[model samples]
Target chain A: MTETPSTGQPPEFPRPTAGPPEPTRPAAGPPETPRPTAGPSQPTRPTAGPPEPSGRSSARPSQPSPRSSGASPAPDSQSSPGPSGRSSARPSLFTPAPGAAPVGRMLLAQTLFEIRLLLRNGEQLLLTAAIPVVLLWLLTAAPVFDTGDYERVDFLVPGILALCVMSTAFTSLAIATAYERRYGALKRLAASPLPRWTLLLAKALTVLVVEALQVVLVGGLGLALGWRPSGSPLAVIVLLVAGTLAFAGLGLLMAGTLRAEATLAAANLVYLLLLVLGGVVIPLSGFPSGVRTVLELTPTGALADGLRSVLADGAGLPWGSVAVLAVWAVAGLAAAARWFRWD
Target chain B: MPPCDTRGMSTAPAVEITSLVKRYDAVTAVDGLSLRVAAGTLTAVLGPNGAGKTTTVEICEGFRRPDAGSVRVLGLDPWRDGAGLRPRVGVMLQEGAGFYPGARPVELLSHLARLHADPLDVPMLVARLGLESVARGRTPLRRLSGGERQRIAFAAALVGRPELVFLDEPTAGLDPQARRATWQLLDELRAAGVTVVLTTHLIDEAERLADQVVIIDAGRVLAEGTPQELTSGVSDDVIRFGGPPRLDVASLRAALPDGSSVKEVAPGSYEVAAVVDPRLLATLTSWCAANDILAEGLQVGHRSLEDVYLELIGAAAERTAP
Candidate 1:
């Protein structure tokens, strides 16, 4: 409990620099020591010995004293290094080797903290998990729209899964990150030993974890609604990973560059547009050929088409759509890294 | 908490700045400011608001770049060697400006601790800062009081066992108890050979805690020395005594030596500014006795750090005014 001494409540510590040791407490009070101001000798450096009374008038006489109170402006405080037990030669008294934790451990710890934050936030849960589930139920069970010759549940599940990835990886991430930037958290981390790249990687991993739960929730809801999925498990996972990377990169770029309020407004707007125009709830076949060609080039459109062809039609690998998403992933991540601002 | 490279640093300053100049748009925030902080001692950059205190410290922390000057922290260029220094230095930005509103104290501290090679125990730090209640709560940081938020920022900064630390206004807006606790922790850190450089607007904070105080105003250093040197250099220690509220000031001025100024600064609080000697002391007391008054609480010390600060700031402002 030697370390416990400093951890005690602060009331015992005197303001003057002289109260360094536990024994100095008695000297800090008024009764034991005579006022230095009362005599000519009082002007001698009050930087040593007992703590002086804290008053504006007495401040000069009571200013920092060497190791008596543990600090002095004498510029030689380093020579003493008086707290005991350790050689003064070592670079740091706090640790034998002062440096950051191994990168993997740091990543793991930060990811856990991020997951806790996401799980606790009602809004984040609704957007990343609940909203997608609600969309699946409404589009299929409600009989709201004609989803083509295929079963309604079958046509909508893959598109809804794509929407789920977009929500978790992009919209939620961008808004959260924007606010973190606005609040000085990014700047604070920038100053810490944790590299900025590690922070970004950790955020991506957290998104992936949440996205997995999302797939389970939305897919489970789809299965209950009489939807039958077709597709290689490996191909489905690869498409999901590519979409997450693309969306996450763009989300982080907006958060690191834009104002939090602006990011909030813009992220929601982009989400709604992608849901309608990217063939999530609306079939891409309904658009004119020229318009469909452009929509197919968008990140959301590429992900939806890839997921739909693989799951709804069992059409196997869709190289063109996968290539589009990979391009977006590389380009989006590079742009984000180049332009991101910490504050 | 001694610096990572202590060799040859016995004489080397922990921080060295020369003619640093920084401007944002048209406003020159720091203009040709130069300073040196000796290793393992606490240096307080004391100034009034807008004195460029934050800007100067920010440059040292490598968060902001100085346009015209060079800054070296622990013998490494702060800008180019920032990553290398991160493990050895801790920085607390002003006012805890962006504590994640959604975070609680323990969660944030634990997260920051994980980023460092070694950190203090989270529970001990929480207890040391008197933040145990908030640490365990699920409440968001934004919902806490300003002082609580400040403590949280402080804990995060210190959790990483850094050899040196830069704290900006560490105790501003803190309640009295919390403020004292912060001061105590700083004292202990210095005792362990950790160097502390902080910026503050409170003159007492500098005088009480700093081994060296740098008084700045309008982006320039007006005075630099120990609190004693700054207060004592203006004159010999002042002669303060207590007597009647309205004693004859005009008559007393005439009785004192040619260079002395006499004033009753407050009711029954008399102060005499002069080259104090046995002769001057006798004359004042004899004069008081003849006037049928007792010089109670007679003391000899110069003015407080506040007076020196105000005098310097006022002069600086006047010189800069059109």
Candidate 2:
């Protein structure tokens, strides 16, 4: 590469009043033309640089002449951007045009990355996927509670699915985003040309990806262990999608506003509370009417209601639950959009 | 002048801010700061700890909302047009950003590449950053050195080929050679007409790379100028003579040639300050020769960024102290 002056000023560019003066030395090394070894007027050599004898004060000038030519290539040098060539034509996956297609692509790519990262994390994998599966297996095996005119697996499957969404969206994503904020990762991403919507959608997509895996594993376990779904398969899928959106949106809202440690505490607290109160383990219908009215507004209850209606009762989708989930999703996303701190 | 519009068919400043103020509760992080980064120029924001350098950069990046004043990057408000502005900006934050430990740079780059309008080749980029040897290693992020991780962050930032880039402490812990290489990458970016706004505590870096030196202290701009301009006004040569080898400073100050002032900056060392010709150095050497008083480590010099910074910071602290 051609060595340009270090001023960050292109030749012929107008000098801005705000910029610093041109530096006299490039810090490349001793000047390109070697200074006189002994006297001021020694003939400058083109190459074959003189060797230094250690501790010889004569060669040890206080300031080495700033004339080092062509910096020695380091082991970890970045390759210069080449002119438009063979590889340049192939567009990068994330650089989508400013349209829906690019936005969708960005969301898909980010979601996949998130899922891959979460699955690789031993702690997260155990909590989101393994723990739920283990919990379902253990809970269904015990005879502590009645099947309520249904198979024991029937009641446990939908609840486990709800737990999966909560784990993936509320707990894992919240913790991850909180840490990202604390560490300045999100602030770093904000510097990039990626759209804000693309960033949010990408994160949401990643949660959904993890949730998708959770659904397959838990749903398969439910079927294999004799849990029957009364609702149509299509209705179950719609409900699952809605629940994922709601939980992920809420996760974003919490992660964006709270400190990492605080988010971690709050998410886990919410998770445990919902586990007991939102019908994940206990049925909402079993609660008193006043309690049910309050619980209905929370995302957990709506997710559980939607899941239970589809998986246990085999009933058509409940519009009220759908509306509640939709409201949560919208509100969560909006709140996150307004309050999220990048650093 | 009202703001210069560079939106169409004009080469204008890439960033401009006027008296930018960002206050959080009782603490004002950025106070009455104004700066401009021309298109295709690299401006380094330099300051000591708690100088609000990062806060200022964050405001420019649109990540932090300023409580008062205005900031325009690429002629668009950063917060309002954050998404609209994203495709043209790149950022490399200081720490705690990486993919899952085992994810290859290829995979991560491929994912991030999808978010840009024009992105570089993943394989080529990986090779450039010296990640090719470990390209297939699938090493987890936790295993990489701080320097290696920094490189990964830098690679991620450039993956999008942004029009403007923000680098915060981009080379904090790198070895000398790695730092040089990173500087080369930045130089190349500027050559391609990309605007770079960066922050660093390294004075040598600010002296070498920044087109503009915007110095901040105690949440406000202490000074801004070209390196030469800042240093030039300070008295010229600082002639230091050893003592203990203790020559009486008053006696030496009297014996010094006209236009030189002497002060004891440190015990056993005295500084004779003045702008002098090369002959004055020879004259001093000759004077020591005649007196049989040896002045070892004797040096003549101009004020460096380090000296100016110390003085500026000292003055600012004194003014703000309770």
Candidate 3:
């Protein structure tokens, strides 16, 4: 049996002008110009008949023959206006233009879908939200460690919040994205109409939603343990946002550059290491001077110290730590963008 | 060279590449390859493993950039005008491409549909691909069987109603029935004037479906033509018939026309290789009669498309081997 129908020529068939043919006018104009026009025409026609009539009147006087010519050949074109007078009169549908989904709509759908996937994966959820809540409870109840001058519950609350941000923004995000790259999901998306920036934004938005849930659960637990925040809520908000950006950027950098298995191991290792040494559970002041100075500069340490200052000390904002987080965000994101491979 | 006439047809080829060169450090993947596809036809790229077919297709899809070449898809540079060209192009990857393991097929398909401007109806598409049974169940993509996953991926590719489609090993994991269904869908796409470029290992699929078959090996094109064209002149026709064992080949050769030879490839089966014609057949029959022999089940045919493909690949392998 014939695999392909003989009714039409094959796509590889040579055209009349095969070599160095004249450059054709770009096809971009036809598809883009008519989409917005077609979108509004469908909705507007039912509301007001008078507007369509006026539109037809204007279209007829300006470009009547060209419209007919465009529609005549594309009998199967989905957006082509029909031969009937009423349909052709609309002018917008008669243009035979191909439709493209709006960029903003695509981004929104992608972000929602990403969030759903993150929530559905039991492992991802455990890493991003559940683990942090469990850790917050464990660290506060256990009294084997020294409390020093500050209230033990008060100091540990902010550090766990910082840990939550690191888990969602850095470790979980890095592992998931690396696996997506390995599975060819990122390659598939890259081949679609979804712009690169839209994909990045969608992932970022998904991380934010998950982190928001973590904050609520952890904060509620802190409240039950008699931990009261005396700092400005605005300062806490700024620290959370900045911390998320810094960790997410670093996560993407690892996901983009490393293999899936490598990213998995490295992300988990970094999470555990930072949990102990990055001033999350342990105060930076407890360490010796030289080591403390370096540890305080780490992103996790900066985020934890910054949050502790705002939530425990009622310090307005830790501008120095915020500035450090900002630099890491910029450097990590730039590196990820430069070296990331789609497939 | 004239300005594009108002016939409304875009002058740019659906896919065009010139002198494409891609290398991964020391090894070259695609070398000096050039191809042009018209706006409404199906072309199959056939090759053995590591033949660069995937690399070439990825370049057209804008997934991979060629180290040295100019490439365009639907008149736009696939790399530079990717945002503009992608909406009009659909790509079916080799495998499931790591779909969310827990997502139902319908959910993922609908989500993909929302990415396009005017996509095919998701429910209708699911039914068309015979995915209705699996789609209704809330099985995660990874839990589905191989055939089920392939069908879903196929549906995802066509859901956008793209102007051009690139399929990489689309039927690799499908069953016979699903393979037939996939072929029918490809036929429909061709009828709708959508351009298709596929890479496959099945020679019969390429022979039956492809309007043009491009055979590549060692990162280069070995031959390209219609099935009929490729197999036409490669080998002479063979006349085969059952006969008595151990027939004298020297005498038969002297009796037959020049450039003709007879061999008993198998006991009691004789094969005559030459430009088969009425005269040669008559001579062979008369010789059999004179020798008190009977030729049974006479048949004549030329080399098949498969033979040509194998011959070309074998020769190229030898030529390129260290």
lDDT of 3 by residue, A7-118 (tens): 1222312222122112222222322322333333335435435533443334323222222333243334222223212122222211222345899999899999988888
Model 3: CA > 4 A from native = A1-99, B1-12, B233-235, B240-256, B261-271, B277-299
Model 1 segments more than 4 A misplaced = A1-97, A287-297, A323-331, B1-9, B239-251, B262-272, B277-300
Mark the 10 consecutive residues where model 1 chain B has the least summed lDDT: B1-10
What TM-score, to 2 decimals, does candidate 1 have?
0.81
Please list, in the order the candidates appear, how each scores on TM-score for chain B only.
Answer: 0.89, 0.89, 0.86
The best candidate by TM-score is 1
Q: Give the Cα error of residue B90 in candidate 1, in Å.
A: 1.5
On DockQ, the stronger of 1 and 2 is 1
How does candidate 2 fare on TM-score? 0.76
Tell me the TM-score of each prediction against the true structure: 0.81, 0.76, 0.79
Compare the candidates by DockQ and give the number of the best one.
1
Two-chain DockQ for each candidate model: 0.26, 0.17, 0.10
Evaluate fnat for each of the predicted models and list the values in order: 0.32, 0.13, 0.23
Ranking, DockQ, top scorer first: 1, 2, 3
Q: Model 1: number of clashes?
A: 8
